[model samples]
Target: MKKEFLANLAEILEVKETDITPDMKLGEKVWDSLALLAVAAAFDSIYDKVIPVKTIGKCNTVQELLDLVEEDD
Candidate 1:
């Protein structure tokens, strides 16, 4: 799930797969908002879960986002 999430995120952000390290700060990216919305939509489509925007705002890394997705599960 984490891999899939990362792949989708990288795709949405137009970042290379190698560039999207788990430790990187998502909000520091210039394309964060669009990438985040894409991630949120992907979550809803793939997991049948809707992640709130506030929760999305609080997540800083792929691991944190994965944790939130797991918690939602």
Candidate 2:
């Protein structure tokens, strides 16, 4: 799950998978609407759940986003 997420994020950010780390700030990766959409899509496809934009906006770091994905809700 983690690996697939990293791959998704890598493609979304157009960066190498090694470049991502839990502590990395989404701001540093230029977090934008497109990235948000991509993340939402990934969650929808991977977990078959739709992540709210509001909840997603609350994530400031990669780990937070990862945690959001793992959440039961």
Candidate 3:
């Protein structure tokens, strides 16, 4: 799931997978409104949870975003 998430995010942002680091924040110029929307949709479709855009916007890194949707198990 993590692999798919990273791949999808990289694709959505039109960047190479190698370019995305765990510490890279999505709020960077690379993530425009459309990218955020796409990420919101991805979270819903992949995690079965509709994460709010504002919440997602607060994320500081790829790892942080992934951690947001991580199950508590």
Candidate 4:
């Protein structure tokens, strides 16, 4: 599951697979609002759950998003 989430994030961020780490911040790079929306959409599509935008904002790292997704499960 973690691997899948990381892969999705890497795709969204347009970064190399090896660049994405649990400690990396999704918003740290130049990703704009559209990227975030795409990420949220990806989360819903893959996990069958809606992660509120506010929740995403509170997540500073990939691990935080993973925790949120796991908690939803």
lDDT of each: 0.76, 0.84, 0.81, 0.81
lDDT value for model 4:
0.81
Q: Which parts of model 4 have CA positions greater than 4 angstroms off? A: none
- Return the clash pairs for model 1, or none: none
lDDT of 3 at 1: 70
Q: Count the backbone clashes (under 3 Å) in each candidate.
A: 0, 0, 0, 0
Q: Per-residue lDDT of 1-73 in model 3, one digit per residue for the tens?
A: 7787788789878899887877876666398778888889988887787889998888879988788778553
Candidate 2: global Cα-lDDT? 0.84
> Which prediction has the highest lDDT against the true structure?
2
Model 1 — TM-score against the truth?
0.80
Error of 4 at 55 (Å): 1.2
List candidate 1 segments past 4 Å from native: none
Alpha-carbon RMSD of each model: 1.7, 1.2, 1.9, 1.5
lDDT per residue (tens digit) for residues 1-73 in model 4? 9998889888888888789899987677646777768778987998877988777777788899888788845
Q: Which stretch of 10 consecutive residues in model 1 shows the poorest summed lDDT?
A: 27-36
TM-score for each prediction?
0.80, 0.87, 0.83, 0.86
